[model samples]
Target: MPSSAGPSIDKITEGGRVTQVGEGQDADESAPPVMTFGAPVAGEILAERYELVEHINNDSAGRLVWRGVDVVLRRPVAVVMRYPGGDSATEMLQAAVAASRVVHPNLVGVYDAIDEAERAYVVREWVDGRSLRELVADGPLDAGRATAVGNAVASALAAVHATGMVHGNVHPGTVMISDDGRVVLADARTDGADSQENDVRAVGGILYHALTGHWPHAEAPLHGATAGHGRAAIPDAVRDANGAAAAPRQVRAGVPAYLDDLTMDLLDDSVAPPSSDVLAAELARLDVPADDDYLDSNGPLRFAAEPGEEPSPLAAAGGRKVAFGIAGLLAVALIGLIIGISTLGGESDDPKTDPVAAPSQSPSASSAPAAPAVRDLKISAARIIDPDSRNRSEVRDAEKVFDGNRDEGWSTETYPTSNFGDFKRGMGVWIDLGEERTIKSVQVNLSAPGASAELLTGTVTGQSNESGDKRVLDEFKKNRIGQPFEEHDGTTMTFNGFDADQKYRYLLFWITELPSNGNGYKVGVQEMTVQGS
Candidate 1:
């Protein structure tokens, strides 16, 4: 029998109800003992708070899903647990912690994370819904509904992208639709296996699956995505042997030509995917209007006008009456003000000094110091100073760092551990500021929080040099400027000291330490501003 305080997960036998053979029977009633289970059995309250009610499904990565309850709050929750907890579980818990930072209507809410050494689990909102995989299991959905689903997922990704984090995983299994018609994206992995561009491409797969009842990417970790082949066989654009995935229109009817182009463009590696916010807005525009005229995108509000209702009295009179009333009031006030001004003019006093006399100009005013021109000294060139050839390709492209756009800056690849993977010395961006000038300050903006770097200026005109040959700015060595990056407050690095005004043509902004971003060690320099003359 199910308990009133907590729901029962045990099955009923022919003879009677079935449960753990021995539960409270062997316990001493004086004190509640720390209940332990050999396995994740039902009725087990983990951390003495969450009670596991029923087992859901296990993910491809061996994370166990369970429908649990928060005993303190008396509310249902979903628990994703992994046993023999170590690095993998630690990564999962970290991912959960990072995901918890963002709150959105289309994102699954993370409640808490628990690591018991032996096992680690993430507690999240219990969504009463079905995964996108399950929804498209029988057949493809209608075109309009498919676009709506894509729009919601894209909006969620936009939020995640705004935070400088990627949703690494965005397959059918992670997309969920509630019984009450809510669409949400869930379970962001912090492993950094996929990039933001990959997340955009996954949306294309979702569109293809909804139109043809087949998974487009067979290698994707989505449940039931691959049956035999490496990737789910997609029709249409698969040229003789080039492995080009086909457009949706070629595989199924009713798929609009424009929609087909958009879908294929995402799947095509040659073409770059649009930003998540751009894609979301586009999908929203393409979504069909709801059946009711007054409902609009969302349902009607209490004071909203009905479709065929008569105009209200104020609206029928239009804005003319209100305008005339204000004008009349203004006329009365203007008349009284004109009379007062005339009376003051009649009683005017004698002038104290010449009204048109101008202030004397100083002799230095003739050569008025030319306003100090402040312009961004364009970077003559930039190159990655990676001593280790192994991590050469892993370095972010140098061109983006000086592009002047924060959204497209360079980023380092994910390291095995936080401190430069423990072996590598570090990586730096060697830049030429065209010609030497008084460098007043060097400002840097990073993507994630805690990163430590030094503004290095060297006389070496060569493109690259080893760390030993490079000279750190005197202020940094003196512990004046180039302080450690802040945890959450200040990301700006201003190297303004007595020595900062010196002129230097070659400058190296080197990162010596990486910040813990819940994931592994990764840092991105999005914007760099050099204020000098």
Candidate 2:
């Protein structure tokens, strides 16, 4: 569970029940104890004053049913366990090891873990909505809704894989609806590693049912027997005299072609499913009502994965060599220009001349002054309009998410809402622009203890080394804090400058204090506009 904010998790005790907690009730006696199995699991009952209620949801492995509390902190949560026969305790432990590593929203939260007594139980955030299996019991989801669900789960999986773990189990039955109006992935550990590859395969299974309303694995559609106003439909994998329901595109006209192809690919085992990274990229590209936001071909730069010596070392080093050479040359020229200016006598008579001379005009100026060189050359003025109007910004707190528009953005403390660790989160962006351009002004909107919004702006230009290309670019934003942004109240941070030209294809902005791990970095954006010289 995200340790970012909200409140602490409720602990478990022996002889607990699921049907007794709620919105406003005493903490000690909320839900009815487990009737099917008497008594709660033994422990200190960390919940200082809450009661247990009835079961809200349960899987074949364990029941995550809800229980109300009898005391103050009256909220609903679930206790998950699959201690029955088939799988051994060791297997469940391994599953926990893998599941505990992933920290993200869409995934369910795993609070407490008891590896003793040959039993393992996970306390997860309780969701009040029905199971997705129940939602599609009558039929699979329409392509539109299916795509939305697929996007959410895919994103969830991407976050899990980022931490080197797999969601071994992914079926309609394991996905759940939250009381908070968000989709939740409920069963990540039930399947284990043998299910890893199938785990990837299951994404397709989910998309299939979501789009067609039929279970490809089942002989006939599970929902076929369900009665509705009209005739029932069959799974996409199966054909009947009436024929399977029209293709997803036929059912819903605007379904993306990639999704249609992805579903069919699941039918064949010979084909390899996409990596979560690749799948995420594709889905991001297929976003709805599409227009051209700059497309980035390279990965992020902050943490560059190294290549083995055997791989073409020369090719990999070529770009860096050229970049280094350019930097060296620029350094030399700056030194030479400063020396020449100190010896020369000519001075500009232009009306616009100031106390400081311009670099282009005064090649012999004694000093170049900290003008363009001081600014992060990573960005240049691809264009500048209305020189008189300048924009300046500085990031004092956390990096914020850019609103689809530029002026408005929000922050997220617990970035990936599923993290098990106490400190983990970040703020990021998916930038859209025609080409690179220098920033002129930077503004950081912050909210600290007693303040609503603290705005700050400055000119710092050492960020020229950041990369924007065919790879991921998780660089410390030129003006962003090295630490992940969290704990601080939500803020809107913007960096602007006009002396440098940004050369990257797209700027997926991310600035946080902790680059090693995600920090509570959630920023929302409103809009960003660029002008031509």
Candidate 3:
């Protein structure tokens, strides 16, 4: 359950009836007739598999949120149930089914969606963290942290949009951060009432909220904001008398100019929001370094010209054939001038002893190739490499290492000793850069100091499936790249030992030892980034 600092509400469960008691409201007066009429009790088992443990709270739409357990899997799950199902529950069920189709690390996993005529409920991965709404209740996030949150949201949106669908509900409440530092976007509303463009715009809203500690979209009420409930908890954006919300920079100090511009552009009705993928890429580009001071020279994001739209003057000029023709003429004239000078000077028979110099080499005629530009490479996919584990459940949250937020990450299970309780030799996180890319450097940020890790690389082969993952893991363990980073005692590790001449596709950050965690030993990767062409 999300940790809240708000006013407490007393919940009473009697004779299978649930009543919510708030300040200044009597239990009899606050309890609606719906509470006693077939409402699910705390211990009631639904569909004979899900057993409700605790009723968390009721949403604005009167839906109940319960901390439940999947009896068969024995895993915690969040069960969202709405009463009098049938037609009223179609949208929720449909959204769950649609959300379940696309699987991404940032998006919440939809385990099961069931409608039992009288009631409908969605069983989802239970997150043991707070929402963005709760996180910002005290104040705003720093610029870098805000950017990271926005990046995670945009990445999730990109994945959702890739499947030709929209996550209609995208706000602080829907963005969940787990205890282990995983940022996940949850509770997507695929009601068709929102457009894909709107979904992208909502990411900007998320950024605004994160940076300014206020919800920007006052026109559209927040998803869980009720009349006297969650709405007041989230304050509206600070606006001028002219009815314009202040930019993030205006609201807070030290915000990067590029970030402020991107946030405002997303919220601006005049400017078209970039597609989710583009936005995610831009955010990932900005989410660098392990600190909050984002003073990078990477300027504001620029979107490509829309089809049928006029290009900028510089852009148009660069693409014109006349430009190239003029450059060619200039090159020819320069060469001719050089030749004429040489002829007028009466060149000697021996070129080495000539009084006049031969035609000077043009700048473009240089024999040396230009250096490849180093950049932050985009990771297409990532997963945990725990071949020794029986169930491989530890691989589920591997995406957190690359999710942009340095505060959130993936951790190995705690062991009695740093050597994994002497059960396994090691475990790691493997990342795929989509295709082969020039090798440069890889940075890994850990939760604590003194944990030992290594950087290894291997060629990509086999189909991108379960068998393929197994094969890749086997190959990586057998064929080590360079040498392992041994006796590492720092929280941050940078592997710049990559060969400049080599191209790498698959790389592994293998953890051989865990830092002490008081009672036991565990290690967590807060963030990981790769830099290459």
Please name the candidate that would achieve the greatest lDDT relative to the true structure.
3
User: Ranking under lDDT, best-scoring first?
Assistant: 3, 1, 2
On a 0 to 1 TM-score scale, where does candidate 2 land against the true structure?
0.41
Runs off by more than 4 Å, candidate 1: 1-38, 219-241, 292-533
Q: Write the per-residue lDDT of candidate 3 for residues 1-533, one digit (tens) a residue.
A: 11111111111001221111000111232564354555788888999999999877665556677789999999998888888788999988999999999887788889999998878999988877667776676577766677768877888888889999999888777776665555678877766888889999998899999878887877754764643453334678888888789887666543555677889999899987889988887777666643322222343364634566655564444333345457767988999999999787875777656645556668887688779898888787777776554323245456667767788687775566777767776778889899989967899999988787777778755443345656766787765655666656788888887787878888988889888877467778888999999
Model 3: weakest 10-residue lDDT segment is 5-14
- In order, what lDDT does every prediction score? 0.63, 0.42, 0.72
Q: Give the true-structure RMSD of model 1.
A: 26.1
Taking the candidates one at a time, how many backbone clashes does each contain? 3, 133, 1
**Which candidate has the top score in TM-score?**
3
User: What is candidate 1's TM-score against the reference?
Assistant: 0.46
TM-score of every candidate relative to the true structure: 0.46, 0.41, 0.52
Poorest stretch of ten by lDDT in candidate 1: 16-25
Question: Which pairs, if any, clash in model 3?
Answer: 181-408
For every candidate structure, what is the RMSD over all alpha carbons to the true structure, in angstroms? 26.1, 18.4, 17.9
Residue 261's lDDT within candidate 1 is: 67
Residues 164-220 of candidate 2: C-alpha lDDT, one tens digit per residue: 677766666665544443555655554434444565666677777766565565432
lDDT of 2 at 16: 19
